[model samples]
Target: MRSCIWMGSEEKRMAPGQSGPKIRLAGFTKFEKKKSKPYSYSRTAKLLERFKNRMSERKDAFGPQVERLTVLHATVKKIADVERAKKHAVEQTEEVELVE
Candidate 1:
């Protein structure tokens, strides 16, 4: 059987005079126009600058913590290795060698 895959349609089906649905209450009388809020360029710029500074400081803060964790993990691994070696040593000491 033949098969076809559809991605995005290039044609527009909506006409120029067509309108969408609107919701309204039965007893509503007051209808106020929504006003667009004014954009603050200075405040946005300041916040973006502060955000960049905080992001830069995060690396320095986490750098020490990451190093500390690495050192702790390495120390723990070394202790485990020493413990394993000690166990092998004790087992070997308690073993009886077969005489030929």
Candidate 2:
């Protein structure tokens, strides 16, 4: 009742009641680094910083647009309030043209 673990890829047994010769671990390929310059910390940092700077520049470009949008939103709200009041009024509205 002697048993041995199937240690070889082609001859190894994966479960009980399996019998086979021990597998050899030879000829396994070793990982070699590619023939190129290794990664640099400074280069990575510069790339990340450039990305952040570009994003900040875009945000700055939109700064004035944001203020305009805020003012436009307030103006639209006021127009809506006026329209609501006009709708609630029983008096007829006259279209008056002001000569500037």
Candidate 3:
């Protein structure tokens, strides 16, 4: 079997059971390959430094908020403990009265 692929003004053929599509490089089209630009080490370094600075600033900004949340958590836990103690005491008194 054979398949046809249209590229620009030419029709390329592909054989049966082929692993990949056959591309013809013998024609000129509207699309042309351009040379890739060179990499810049200084630009990459500046970007990385900026990213690190932002991360540190975020940590500093959230530090106080995190500490306040921790303090609130401890306070809630202490209140829960007191409530549990009161509940236990009430249950114990009910049990003693039933025994008597």
Q: Judged by lDDT, which candidate is best?
A: 3
TM-scores, one per candidate: 0.34, 0.29, 0.39
lDDT of 2 by residue, 5-38 (tens): 6445654335666665654567746656679885
Worst 10 residues of 1 by lDDT: 1-10
Residues 1-100 of candidate 3: C-alpha lDDT, one tens digit per residue: 7767888999777778775565567675446779888534344444545554555577777676556555555565566667668889999999999999
Worst 10 residues of 3 by lDDT: 39-48
In model 3, which runs have C-alpha deviations exceeding 4 angstroms?
A: 1-61
Question: Once superposed on the true structure, which residue ranges of model 1 sit more than 4 Å away at CA?
Answer: 1-61, 97-100
Better of 1 and 2 by lDDT: 1
User: Scored by Cα lDDT, where does model 1 land?
Assistant: 0.56
Q: What is residue 6's positional error in candidate 3, in angstroms?
A: 54
Model 1 sits at a Cα RMSD from the real structure of: 21.7
